[model samples]
Target chain A: MKKLLTLTAVGAMLAAPTFADTLRLGAATAQTGGLAPYDAPVMEGIHIAIDEINAAGGIGGTTKIELIEKDVRSDAAQTSIAVQELVDTGVSALILPCDADPSLAAIGIVSSAEIPAISTCASSPTLPMIGGDYMFANFPGDNVQATVSAAWAQEQGHDTAYIIYSPDSQYTTMPLYFAEVFEKMGGKVLGQDTHSIGQQDFSAIATRIAALPEQPDVIMTSSYEPDFPSMLKALRSAGVTSQMIGSDGIDSPTTFSLGDAGEGVVFTTAGYAEEGSPLEAFNKKYMDATGSESQTVFNAVGYDLIKVIEAAVLAADGSTDPKALRDAIANLENVQGATSAITYKGTDGMPVRQVSLIRVKDAGREFLGSPSPDAALIPAPRMQ
Target chain B: MDIFLQQTVNALALGGTYALLALGLAVVFSIMGLINFAHGELMTIAGYVLMYCGIAGLSFVIAVPLALLASVVAAVLMERIAFRPVRNGSGATMLVTSFAVAMILQVLFQNLISTRSQPVLLPAMLSDSVHIMGMVIGVNKLAAIIATVVMLVFLDWFMKHQKTGIAMRAAAEDFAVARLMGIRANTVIAGAFALSGLLAGVAAVLWVSQRASVDPLMGFMPVLKAFIAAILGGLGSLRGAVAGGFLLGFIEIYLSAFLPPEMQEFREPIGLGIVVLVLLFRPNGLIPSATLKAEKV
Candidate 1:
């Protein structure tokens, strides 16, 4: 009777669809709070891509991609809870928040369930290293981005640089990478200072920079909006006229919206919307879908994440099985995306994608060509 | 000498804002025995008003008054709608109620305005710096110091001379006796919230000047610091709140200026540790109130 019952259950399963008609992708990204500026755009890009893909032919030309999203509210504890809730719903893959600390919060659940997870735009290489094989960061590594900035600064003849870094999170520690590569390129680090996140007053930091006998040729930091604007205003107000170099954290309307205060600041990001490039096309779609022009590279980063998943599904020959998907994604090579051709194969889970150098010119982003730094100069990921 | 002068100005500017906020919290807590965590929301209310006024292209002259008024009105309504029903409950109940009010206000701000920080444009002169004796000082920082001093003076007169102010003070000293002495509990409590809201508004303007933007959670940090300042001084003692605010500001700025670069990240912990040491020495805070001392005895 038991054998017959098992055979009947197997027969019923075979009678159902041969493969899942829909693939559930769970996202626990910040819709509100501090991380919203980055995660919101990325989510919009993801939405646009999912809509375009499902409308065209769905992933692997059959299974529709279904997004099950929860706002983590930029809270780490909430990230874990949201991830667990999504996992309980049997999601095949997870899209975590855009910061390393919050994304790290969801790793245990996703890794234990063998479900693959990807951060929207966390540049920290530590995500993959710490989250193990099943976790991936869908953006360029911090070391890679920082190296690009340092190389660009060298090319611009910036011989001495001062750094203001926040030791608060892995995301804010990009200055260390920049400092390492800058020194490797024979540039002198004039000074390095620290600011806590949510620190509104930058007068002390600015005063220190201004008090230097000979001002450095450039200043670098990884501060984001709210803090970034105040920092720039304080530095400029304090008469520190050095060229400012920032990481992708400053890629927000708030930065450009500073008008004259933000003028001539350069930052490194995941992609440049080069004319006629895939990123440019995505920007067009984004404007139509959201009725606002894409302001940051994060929109492209979000578009790439969906493209990556679709490519993996097709590469796995239309299997939605978690392990099969993870293996296929780990082996994906040169999958052309909105940002650049992403290759996860043989690179652990951190993609060596193109890094766009952007200038805050005339209150808007000016795309400088994606320049690949000398690989040897790129610093190793800081484990801490 | 130049660096000393500059940081002193910075410390004063920061302390002034914290003092106003701490005084605001202390005002309500002294009268009601309820730590109004939602006092931050009053500041947030003022900030959002500034944002809206900026959007409407209103000049700062008009915007400032409108923003202050908005905060005062919001505070009155907040008490009427939320606190009145729970007024007769335990202190813990009112404390939880204030937290709920804060959370609800934050959610409303997120949904109604934006989850993102909205830029609040002030007069461009606010960003300008003045040079005096080889030292540069921000015009906004000076404004904050002046504003705080002016408010403090006015508050001093109001508390000492006004009839309603005396009533509120008497109520804070002993609510039951003040009620028997003909001070209406409702009127005095409402007056306290209004005064608290006004103080929060002034602090918010100083804060908003520095950031030039406002988000739903913008008030969280300032209020948290102010709460600490209030406790460090003595929760119900107005003078203690002011002293605590200045002390916190001085400690923070001096540490930032003097601490080695490698130890800069430890500034917060060290600041709190210093506060703990001070508290250990003076368990009743720097200036415990007579009523509080009597209750302790």
Candidate 2:
């Protein structure tokens, strides 16, 4: 009778599916090129989150989360290949960068593979709609920040604004989206100028701003590091001096190079480096682990996504099954991350997070209060 | 009126910078018949050196000379290691040699430094603009025009009067004949590379000053535009190079400024199209190389 009972136990164990005790997360992001500076911090944040999760007994103490990373090098073609490799290697979930164009290149593959994927920082509002149910935006869409900044501008009584943007993906699209929102709020878009990345002269553009029929109340630009400081310096030198505003592209600490010019520069971001915020402990831990301070706001994207995945993995009951994990992610709500309060709302998986507005003072960034754009009080007229 | 005047400043500043780059290309082409495709890399190196010095907290005054010196050394070494060995090679071979040099430097820099851009801070005065004649011009650009004019004058004088410069011009006329006529091939070729490198260094500072960022590929567009200008003015004709540089600059700046907002995206295509049309009409370029015919034998 004992032998028969032992045989039945072995048969039951064999009949059930067996899986690895370790849960794997794959990060396919640009490790080099224009995306490197932003993505590097993101990867560090991911590892940091994983270490914290692992230290806390790692999702129910039975399964430890492990990460495998692939450097896409900012090439869209390579992104697809990287995605396949990660999927084949058996990652339960994937983390991606915030750019919509390149993210789209591989998002489809992750969907077809039927694994849950999250973009840490991509802001194109349309990203969530196009990416399948499993595709989630870890950071809130561009419209959220645009609305907040536009509302802030209106509160400051700046009714007319000028825009200068570069042709790069986020820099081009995001600011123009800001223009659309600003105009919808009954603000005048005085003029718009566009320059390619690394353009040598902003004088013509700068001059165009200076010569406007009436100087604008603000010069809002969608520009990033290396270029942002330079462009700001040029505008300051051109003596326009109207309040300068921007999106997260101007969120880097390196803007300190602008000296006095960077002062009074206002921008909106998902993350800011303040001493006693909720993220202080996480920030210190990241600095302790990485041996350097974070550089850009996108750092939160990586950290937040990992946190999201942790919750999802736990909810899915340590299942490495892609469909199960994806459903868990879609169900996430009101999860606090190092960056913001993240909630994947409704069926679209469009994350809703409170946007933080920041301004540069004394060559440093100061966090302004989180001003939520009212959804019901007034609809920002959509401008084409 | 203010807009037009502002764009005019933009045009002159661009034209002046382009002229310097074209002149650099012209000097080497005149002597070597090789395109010296790596000339732009010299510019990149200068910007890198400037960026390094800026990070070290060195004053711009001290950094500028060091950056130029670095560019000159790089240019000389490039000729020694890359160009001299293949001096007698065919045009196709030499062209490939320049490309190989450019690639090697580009890759080396990319690996050693971040492939991403490194911001270089300039003196605060550079970004300051002065109001003059109803136009606000960035002071750095005004200085660029003045500096380019000075450099151009110095280059012209050196070419016409200096013995080494005369030898360079002679070699351009006929490399083998000049070598036989007691014009040292080594000195003339080295001098051409040195002179070209110096101009590239100056142009690099002016070019980088406006953008305030340096990257491995920073030189690509500037050099490509300079190359186009060199070809537009007759590849080896120094005078033609300057004219073509200014012409191309004016075309690009004005097109961007005046093209309707919707059509502005087509500016680059329009500028390139103009170049193509000019090439079609002037097959040898607006100013072809001055051919030195042998005495009727």
Off by over 4 Å in 2: A1-19, A51-60, A166-171, A376-384, B83-111, B183-186, B291-297
Tens-digit lDDT track for model 1 on B24-137? Answer: 999998988888999988989999999889889999999999989999999899889999899999999999999999989988888787676777877778777888778787
lDDT, candidate 2, equals: 0.78
Give the Cα error of residue B264 in candidate 2, in Å.
2.1
Tens digit per residue, CA lDDT, model 2, B143-249? 88898899989998999999998899889888889989999888998899899889999999998777677877677778888999998888888988998888888
Give the C-alpha miss distance for residue B277 in model 2, angstroms: 2.5
Which parts of model 1 have CA positions greater than 4 angstroms off? A1-19, B294-297
Worst 10 residues of 2 chain A by lDDT: A375-384
> Compared with the true structure, what per-residue lDDT tens digits does model 2 show for residues A1-384?
756755653454344222436777788888765666667667768888888888987767766787888888777888888988777666778877657667778877987888888876777666766776767776656677777888888889999988887655653556676787788888999888877765666665666666667998987776775567667766777778889888776666556556667778888888665677657767787778878776665666677878888777777777766788888878778788887778774747767787888888886777887877776422232222
Estimate the lDDT of model 1.
0.87
